[model samples]
Target: MADFLNNLRTFVRVVEAGSFTAVANESDCTPGQVSRAVTSLEEELQALVLHRTTRHLSVTDVGTRFYERAKVILADIDSATDEARNATESPVGRIRVHSSPGLAYSEVATALASYQASFPAVSVELKIEQSMPGLVEEGYDLSVVSATQLPDSAYISQALGAAYSVLVSSADYIARHGLPRKLTDLADHALLQLESPVSAADEWHLQSADDTHLWTITRTPFRVNTPDALRAALFAGVGIGTLPTYTVADDLASGALVRVLPQYHLRPFTVFAVYPSRRYLDAKVRTLLEHLRATLSPALANAMEIVETFTGDATAPPASPPKRVAGTARKRPAKRK
Candidate 1:
């Protein structure tokens, strides 16, 4: 409380001044107000910290013990304030960042390069893991998470991009088994699954032009929780699997994997950079998050752009007949004599 912190001040003053009126005079407040501050502190703590009579005031055992600890707390606060004031001209602190493995592999490392180069004075301690560490609980300044929605109310979510899952398989596997002509065609193919709560890993919903298609598998060759693992299985030609686009965008461009149903959309795993309450956002945290938004979002979008070029819109009708060149046919080669 604003008034409560000063009560610690008033308590110490009363202990040193040894009189309510004397303490009040030094603090330039009414004796009654000074008396109330100390009284409220005791009431708040449920401890009788002081004994006061008309002319005499004394500290009780609790008051003496509290005074020692309160002095240390006040001193620490003063030191923190001094450091903050001194660094007002430039940001200089270690920003602890935690990120989900998916993002850590995809964009966090790329963004951190420019971020560190830009803010040389601010150091970073980054942990790339799956744990959903709270901003305050785990002393994290920021976190990048792969989730469809906000993880908690205590933090603000800055959407970086959407996590797109696409059906893919190695080129060799597709050349061997053949591409599925439609959703139903998947029933005959070997499928690798991801452990999912939205539905069984074997169940998939794909959005078509005017309707949505749902396919369930009675037989699955493999199932895993992380997208990277699913991608690994697909790369090994284990089976056709659904993998996030962020993780496989490069592979798609290099012809390592091909999209099965380019026209349909898979469930999106939304992306967010979560940070503590915005009220106290510091310079270092602000700069790093800005860097992430500027670089990571565009990189992911551009990578996925390659995938989109192959998939063309599902609702749009098939490409119209190719326009023919008018009167531009090549002349026949002269017969040899």
Candidate 2:
């Protein structure tokens, strides 16, 4: 079986290389050995897998069909091998992660790179999505989200950290228009908005020392679907708009953008790592959660607090494992939510 698999791989390489001699050269083997492997595979399958000549090689009709199916089988076998090995090995499989584009722009990308470096055998596919998908149904290994509430489903959830959106404007805009002293003052300022299921692009939900109110802008200069684009507009001095702190932490430090309202925040955007209900969690998923909880979550959730309290007076967070947070029978929220 092992020899057959090797021959199958050799066949694939030969097809791609277009010559047994080329494949043998690459493999540091003789051309006859490569030809023999393919010949053995053909004999076993009783089909003409390839037609070879002095200068060219082409797949026969049977070879084309066999090659198509062979690739799938080979991939399946590799995945299965990884799964079985990972049972005893460390987390070593490809983890499919879904995250909001805004959140992903922050510590998520950094955390992923760090995790991949720590676990070189593991791979990750981080998809940027605004809508949270059903984990089990959609085949997502994990979902990283920032929301006030998550859909009550059969998934276990954990509070990675507390994140929030802040109203911001270009330094030039703030310099030219002056800062708004009150929430109502925004009525006179230009605005940019992002449309999502939970919040209307044109509507702003704000809370100040006095009260919480939803204000709809009369005139929106730009309404973009992406946080990145909205940020660009803010950079161009389009108007004042709310953006995730993670998206603008560096900008704030650089003085490119200034927080429009320091006293008021829209709402707490809590970050959560959600996964499907299962008897056992995959190591890849578990390690990713661990990494996020330990690193990204804290940095992301507390970025505003850090930026606000840059007096160099704040103490560092305790070096203990984070509390797994949730709303259902699974792990629930820590003190974070």
Candidate 3:
């Protein structure tokens, strides 16, 4: 009965549209195709739904009655279909996300705020760490990490965006110490380093056209384990520090900090959202991923614009060489000897 009613509505649309050709155009099909579908539907119901001529079309008395009831049935069918699709795809339940302290506070937090508003049924638990947490060990459903390369693991990794590290300092620091016009000039100036446990302890690597440079000396007078702390220190005129473009975008915009080495570029790091393997993932994760993909595209584009605004360079420098550090080791003594 429902199937017959559904077809009856299609027949009615053809009649209202004035001709099968008009209905076919509206339905994105050929006139003959629409005609055949109507014919098949009529045969299945053992009823002639319309009186058609080369000039016009008119619904029969039975067709007119069926159209009145068929519209209601068709509306109900559409409502049911929409509900089913929404239930299967809607973001609901609890989701756990782990991210770096910097991103957690800046982009990730903002993205979650909008996501929450759009999907009220979903509850999000965010954990901020200095480094990417072990997804299985920490029991996180998703983790955002910045890395040069993704390891060969069972987890799925999607690149949310990319950013490069830049040496930056407060205007006061530069005014007092003077900006270093060359890479070698930094040896005489103070440097601030990120002391995250999960990151390499080696020298900061920089790249230029056909040249690779490494600044390894701990000439860094101040060091912090987190990006937030590093930003605060830099804001306080601690020293020249290397940070991601997104992290310093606002500060750079406000003229609180200025780019130091405009010629040399640090290696570009990729931001990835890692998730466990699953044949049928939960709707919440899928929806969040979609939101992230859509939301991050424009954010990343803006980040690139900020980079260009600060660097004043049109071409990106070459990639830097990989440097090993104490952080990557499996285990280490309590203190460095």
Candidate 4:
């Protein structure tokens, strides 16, 4: 159909030029190809469009009427193509983004605000949930997800950054229950659990260097499904739990929460910006993605470095502003049981 559309275009040009050679030269094709284009169109319509003689060519009554209608069709198609091509330059549309609860709460807000400030013509709708929604089925323009390994799917994934989770507890809780000096001591203290898609509900996988330890949760006084709730539980001096460094950086800095086992951390997972396709990516989505890569990735990297520096040292002074860190640091791979 696309080729046939080109033929229709050639026929229109030939009618206006009154010579196949003229249109052929303009199109940079042979006069034979130009003539074939008209021939194909004539065969499809099963009518003679041009009365040809050795000296000249004239349009029949049927050809005259068809030419007018075909001209309008081609013009409309050209107009539509131009508008679509220019959409990337002036983006104006609503973008619906889906994200996990923890990331949406802690990370996406500032990036979204900054993006809106720059591109005031684009509006965004953010939805947060624990489970992953089908991007196309659910009408999502993009999704920000964190996982150890993404399952096989049709979506395109871009790694924004990677960060490890830190085990932390409130100072008051440590004072009341006594600080856990070793991995086994954690069994004696109340354990608050945050159930997440990438985490197990009944166990915590702790790793340091090449050694890995699995701490089974036999008893738990508090278990929640969201990162904010888990952080709140930790703040209330309920028990110790693990949180992403980005989520607890300020708390650790402010002495609201102290690192528990600084040497060991939960497995690091990547944050990904997922979308349906890379071909002709919308300007609204592309700008948002670029903004996040510039802002959010660096923020996560800085948070990891800041938290790593203060690890195992609970008496450290208030943290200064974190400096930007480039490149990922090497760590032992997580061994999950």
Flag the better candidate by lDDT, 3 or 4. 4
What digit string (tens of lDDT, one per residue) describes model 2 on residues 262-299?
76767766788889854566788877888887777667
Q: How accurate locally is residue 247 in candidate 4, as Cα lDDT from 0 to 100?
A: 78
Off by over 4 Å in 1: 1-77, 85-89, 196-200, 312-337
lDDT of 1: 0.73
Highest-scoring model, TM-score: 4
Better of 3 and 4 by TM-score: 4
> What are the per-residue Cα lDDT tens digits for candidate 1 across 26-81?
87889999999999999999999999888788899999999999989989988988
Residue 172 local lDDT, model 2:
75
lDDT per residue (tens digit) for residues 5-111 in model 4: 98889888989999898998998989889888999989988999988776797899999999999999999999989877866666677889988887877677667
Model 3's TM-score against the true structure: 0.65
User: For residues 18-69, could you state the per-residue lDDT of candidate 3 as single tens digits?
Assistant: 7898888888888887778778788996888788888778888887887787
Clash pairs, model 3 backbone:
none
Candidate 3 lowest-lDDT run of ten: 323-332
Model 2 compared with the native: what TM-score?
0.66
Cα RMSD of all models vs. native, in order, equals 11.4, 13.6, 14.2, 6.5
Off-target runs (Cα >4 Å) in candidate 2 are 1-82, 309-337
Point to the candidate with the largest lDDT: 4
